[model samples]
Target: MKLVGLSRQIVLSMMAIALGVTLLVILTSYAFYFLWRIYWPEQACEDSWIPTGPEWVWMIGATICGLALAVVVAVNLSRRILVPLNSVADSIRRMAQGDLDARAVAGDRSLGEASQLADDFNALANQLQRVTEEQAFWNAAIAHELRTPVTILRGRLQGLAEGVFMPDESQFRSLLAQVEGLGRLIEDLRVVSLAESGHLHLQVREANLAAEANAVVDMVGDALQARGQRAILELDTQPVRCDPVRMRQALLALLDNVRRYAVPGQVRIQSHAKNGWCELSVEDDGPGVPEDFIPHAFTAFRRAEGARSGGSGLGLAVVAAIARAHGGHAECRKAAGGGTVFTLIWPDLPETGLPGSNRSGRA
Candidate 1:
């Protein structure tokens, strides 16, 4: 009686057919009984209109054959439905048992819902695989990045303790610099994590976009001078509502990129209003990012071949995150002067307030 894997529609249709067959047999038998009684009243019994022995035998045989046909059809139907379901179940089990590659195959001409379910399952599996790979890659990259500075710090401390190196001012300063670099790397990782989780606290206010750009340029002035690089500022004086501290941090990240990779060249910092947006751009006339690497320029922990010195590969990513937090985005494009231009665009706030005015808001 248990019809495993049988769909309700199929079961109902089969039941209706069986009911119709039964009704037909009952009606035919009753009609014949009435005809016999009407045509031959002498042969008709008053007590019952049951058929004679051979006629009864033939009716019973027909009923048995019809029921047997129904049973055969039910078995075949159950097999057809259960086979695919069993296959899908097996695949799910395999995937649950750490077989990320296992997939359910919905063959051509499969039922609509079954095919859709299979496709969705495959898509989820694909995403899981991708996340797993990314997690592994990030783990290795972080380990490698941390190891170098840690080894240097350990070696310098050991040398000082063992009296193998003098604790001169220059040596102490070098040690302090290494510790600062480690601290910065740790801070960058923290910020990236917060940004990724959407938990980065922002004190948004109305600030002059041009002013923030200029401030960042001034802060990196000493580094630019040391590298023989000159920064050209093109301030448009556009006011925007944003988190000033976070925005400056993002701009500093961009400037840091120029210092690390495009030193000894002209760096341009500009702010302008365009198409209902306030844009901040930093362009440098140095070796440009490779065409293939431009697409992944803002991905966390992704580094380009030419610019791998003294960086944690999270600067541009932080820029993109901060832009997105401001209901905007970041883009990397080839500059007109044969270098790279990094642009951050934010939706323009209403011009009801003066530039650099502070209005309390949360993000």
Candidate 2:
């Protein structure tokens, strides 16, 4: 009953095929009869023109054989086509029922169309499964990340309310810091999510990459200095179209990463044009990321093992997200002097004289 449509189509096809065969047979028989009449006019005029017993037997046997062959062929062809399609339909049903792992089964002997349908269904199922799994992971991770800050805030507020801790300026400052951290985490997650979903809008304007880099460094100069990190600039004027606010956010994330992990040494920030693309990079001579973990460096919440693994691992991911939002990419590699170099590269925009063109200098 479920295959009524397919059955009707197959039946119509068989009927058309049978009609064609019947027409061909009728035409051939008429041709033969006409030729016989032309060649043997005397025989054609005979009164007794009936078939012999042997001829009747042969005609009946041939008709039966042809019908049997057609039935067998139709059954086999229908089976070959229907099986994979049924498998795909079943998989789709299961998927609609919330079984993301459901997949179509296409046997080796399946017809081309059936096999292709199965392949396409399986591909779609695979993508759905991946997206489902990722959503689940993100939900769990977000909960985990938020739990600590929420718990701390609750504990601290409870203590203050119960008079267990004094409401001193320092205590309030500590609470404020935690709140700020929580806010930053939320914002970071929002940015990453929007970028991944292709909804991160940028206020792109013609500006110099070197200028953005310089401004970010200047804004964080005090903090970097306090962390015993010396800033060195190797910047060149390279025009690009980007959101300065987002670009600065990305730069701050990079610098914050350096403050947390990089060794107390020179932090080289550079911007230049290379092969029609502008690159802004930050290099640190600290313990570099592990060779195996470099590939997943830009993945959200993924941190390398050892000393390099600390804090929420979303800074680099946010950098990558921002770069992608600007039609660019972020990359990490080993620096020449033995550390990690993080770079943001995007196609250069039309040259324009935006502000903040500072020559190479130290901070």
Candidate 3:
């Protein structure tokens, strides 16, 4: 039923009940006065006795007027409270029935607690909708990303099985490369998923941040040389509390990104400690990212218009996840000397000398 009318009906019904009780009380008082007159006739005429009939009528009329005023107030108050409450209840029902967009009526008339309730519910609904959209997008993106590599692997293996392609060492190496790519992609996905769920495992300890960066640089040194590029270290010996394995993984991802897309020049790996924070960055020369795409550079499976097509587009996203898991974040920007720089920054927590630490010494 319409809440306004329902409120009015409720007020009137309650007023009717009150009026009936008032009449019954008046009749009972009149009967009691008659009984007193029969039992003790002299006291019936006492000045302090019950009022006369006209006075009784006046008192009853005043009481009815007061009740009428109370009905008006009650109706207005009930509408203010009940209308919005019903609206919220209806919205909740709609949302429970799978309407993520459903929202309560929140307007000037929705006053006090009702207004706050509507605002909170709308905020929750908006969050649920955004999360649902992101989940759907991730599902589709994961399937699309897996299909190409799986197709390549299947095609190669089938050809070999059917004797259509020679099983030579070169062919085997190609197959192995595809398998390795699949493995890396799967691991990247796992890291991202865990990070998103706030369960990414970390063996956090006091370690040398510069050492981790140097280790990644050393490991990828030969690969960059093969690609006609070299690494330049401007590292500082800075200690930080973090998971060494994950930190190395993030650094390697950044360097791999550089190796894949950066121009054939010096790739700089830098580390520094300032303002109670540690920064590890990989900078390259020339061919910077487009200005407009910088904001979304760390989003999963996102690529710039002119980016190389070989990457699975999860490297920077994985870097961001790793940074977040380390109680920090990742960012990308253009270097002053013209190139893209991706940096992982986190707090430099106070040193706690944990045992079995992977604390590589100063760079």
lDDT of each: 0.78, 0.79, 0.81
Clashes of each: 0, 0, 0
Cα miss at 249, model 3 (Å)?
0.4
lDDT of 3 by residue, 57-86 (tens): 756766776677667766776676676678
Candidate 2 has an lDDT of: 0.79
lDDT of candidate 1 vs native? 0.78
Name the runs in model 2 displaced over 4 angstroms.
1-61, 108-110, 307-310, 350-363
For all predicted structures, in order, the TM-scores are 0.79, 0.81, 0.81
Pairs of residues clashing in candidate 1: none
Q: lDDT by residue for model 2 over 41-69, one digit each (tens)?
A: 66665565587453366467557756876
Best by lDDT: 3
Q: Which of candidates 1 and 3 reaches a greater lDDT?
A: 3
The TM-score of candidate 2 is 0.81
Model 2, residue 271: what's the lDDT? 81
